[model samples]
Target: MFGGGGGGGRKPLDYEELNENVKKVQYAVRGELYLRASELQKEGKKIIFTNVGNPHALGQKPLTFPRQVVALCQAPFLLDDPNVGLIFPADAIARAKHYLAMAPGGLGAYSDSRGIPGIRKEVAEFIERRDGYPSDPELIYLTDGASKGVMQMLNTIIRNERDGILVPVPQYPLYSAAISLFGGSLVPYYLEEEANWGLDFVNLRQTVASARSKGITVRAMVIINPGNPTGQCLSEGNIKELLKFCFHENLVLLADEVYQQNIYQDERPFISARKVLFDMGPPMSREVQLVSFHTVSKGYWGECGQRGGYFEMTNLPPKTVDEIYKVASIALSPNVPGQIFMGLMVNPPKPGDISYLKFSAESKSILESLRRRARLMTDGFNSCRNVVCNFTEGAMYSFPQIRLPPKAIDAAKRAGKAADVFYCLKLLEATGISTVPGSGFGQKEGVFHLRTTILPAEEDMPAIMTSFKKFNDTFMDQYDGYSRIIQYYITPSVKT
Candidate 1:
């Protein structure tokens, strides 16, 4: 009627006409709570954005050398300016010149779909040094970010509705989202939250068996070391068990190691899945397929927006790798500048380099600050009347379980929200602090949690925790039968 082709018909891409799978994707990190917080911010409310693991957004300064190298590579014309030497450190300039030489068209050019060969080689060397095993540059796929690599692998693995991937409960939500997007089943294996979110082989075996009983072919299993949200590092023993499980189950292992550099505890230092696999020797190492992912987004680099990441594939057949290459080639290329940033991340300044002292100092300061913040957040949560938090051994998040009483659960029902969601909304409204509800990340029945980042400024963390406590105390009193009485009934918190 309005001179359109369909004459008052519904929009060509109507809601109901959209892909069913698209409608099923749920990423709680930026779900209702984040949206509400954003709306509040728009209305002039001061809101602390901690719903996701984005560090740079919370005022993390980019490392000097990376920015320098990326900037130089982005504008290689500066190298010929002669005065460029005055502005950039010699090492950064030299590194920029090296990458520029590798990429003839520079950052603006579409690199090889597998990423710049030179950068892939750099990543391989980084992996070799990291895992004590050889990495083939041909197997390294530099992604726009680690997330893109994840989706790509998911795409490659999930062939039909019958194919399933074993994902951890209390996952990052990326796996669930991707599985839905690709129209595959997400078979959940619950991590023992009480065990500091450790993997349970019995749980794994049962979950895989259950999936099989339902005719779901379990294709792969994802392991996030120094886990997201939960933030507990996997012990090397856990990895060994996981590899054995994968070998016996004939499942591929997808290791998300984005937070390898973010460990906060010496007792639970980060261990790579590949390292454990190889250390276990022949059949398991030689037979179990593995893909390990890493990114510059989460570490001290905090280059979230920089989109620099790579995943190294081990034991994948040549044809399958070729098919993945074809899928990547469809995108033409990964982000060029991102690849450069990743190169700098894997190969930063050495002790003798001019930028070494400053790089080391900046990285150290950020890490130490995170360490302190993790401690403060954990202790602060444990001190709360109706809250229990395991130590954030690594990663940038602390996912604390909220001990909501029956009355609070009923109140949440009345509010048309999950108990944790209602509590998070209340916390946000009361304290102007934003967080992701536990329901967003899958949790066991009767459990409720909220994930908050430890990325706030160190000085501000104490005040933030204090504010959270004040609001939580009042919230518990108003809904959870008053803290004093509730405390008597509640079990003593566990210390891991």
Candidate 2:
């Protein structure tokens, strides 16, 4: 009675009337994981979050000096009070002032479009030390995070019509999202999982040729060293080969080295792309335009909330450098505190300093714990029946291949879901553990996988592992036919 047939003329909003590419993209894992967790919470269920690489959320604390420096910079007045003198470090105070003096608008206001000169200089020094090569401050630009810088670079190179970027399959989503949003073609090359997630030069050449045949100009090749999700670190030999390939192909090389400090294996040390370029010498060094990105979000700091990062370009043309600066200028400046935070990350306390020993030990312990956790998760997954997981040599995720049964696949399809996604959803429902599916990161057509972070508390990890194993066993039992199909594909048959 309140609303009759002709009550009021109101039309519904058609939110779907937007970009076709955006419509095609899906970020279902995160949303489903969170939603399911919330639902479980309603029933008073305790959920274990393995879907995101957030250390702080799992009770990992930040280093004292870094946090103190940030807080002092954020509010200088607190430092002036006499009672607070004992609470802050004298060296930290001096560092804060130095940062403020170097910051544009004196840390209270916005900075230049590129970033503060002081921080850029510090970044250059850090690069020089790390790469054992000369670096220019002018070539560096501080960003809110590496994600923004990558997107900016993509925007400049990808000029509509025929532009494309070569991204590894099972890549970080940021690359795909940016390319899709900018209407640039995404030419994906597969990483060989059978070979420890190695870069397949044959696949690379084939993908590039195919893209060119389709009239798409492959402008750049994006490499996530210490590969995301898969967690494979590139060797020096591999780096040399990749650099040579990029040089020969005239491809702009984008090296994502945010996880430079997260290497757990002793044999595979983190190698800088710029270092590889310089060591190669001659035309390879001069010909390849490499932009290496670093961030405080990963590694020991794990300061994802800070959004502090930088990109250093080696052998870039002066004109291109200016173009990058001009584009970055639109942002006016990176966040002032974030710039200061980046400075601290690059140039931490020296060995002779008062806090140096403690700081060093604490940082090392955090990294060691992360390494142990990575091993625990990978080992646990491998122990489960029908689950195969490679060692996480570096990076924060364990991407495991799960053998699903026919019924599970059918059920997923019936529910309009990805097979791994269905598997993960059931995993969350049964065990309160959430993870992202491999399809979200672009895996092979028929294979199903899921990515779980190794950032949960060490004490709680075993329980998480047990839950995962139990759920996987239950799922396999329920969907034996799907399991058979997966087993048939993965295991070779023996002929009598």
**Candidate 1 local lDDT, 1-496, one digit each (tens):** 5566855677758997789999999999989999999999999999999898888889888888888888888777888997987899889988999999999997898999999999999999988898898989999999999999999999999999999998888899999999999999999988887677887787788888888999999999998987987898999988888888889889999999999999998888888999899999998889999999999898898898989899999999999999999999999999999999999899888899999999999999999999999999999998988688888999999988887878989988998899999999999999999999988989988888899999998989999999999998898778746444333222345531
Candidate of highest TM-score:
1
Error of 2 at 194 (Å): 1.3
lDDT of 2 at 365: 88
Q: Listing every candidate in turn, what is its Cα RMSD in Å to the true structure after a full C-alpha superposition?
A: 2.3, 4.3
lDDT of 2 by residue, 11-73 (tens): 333455566766655554466766788788789988877777777877788988888888878
Alpha-carbon runs more than 4 Å astray in model 1: 1-5, 480-496
Candidate 2 displacement at residue 190 in angstroms: 0.6
Using lDDT, give the best candidate's number: 1
* lDDT against the true structure, each candidate: 0.90, 0.84
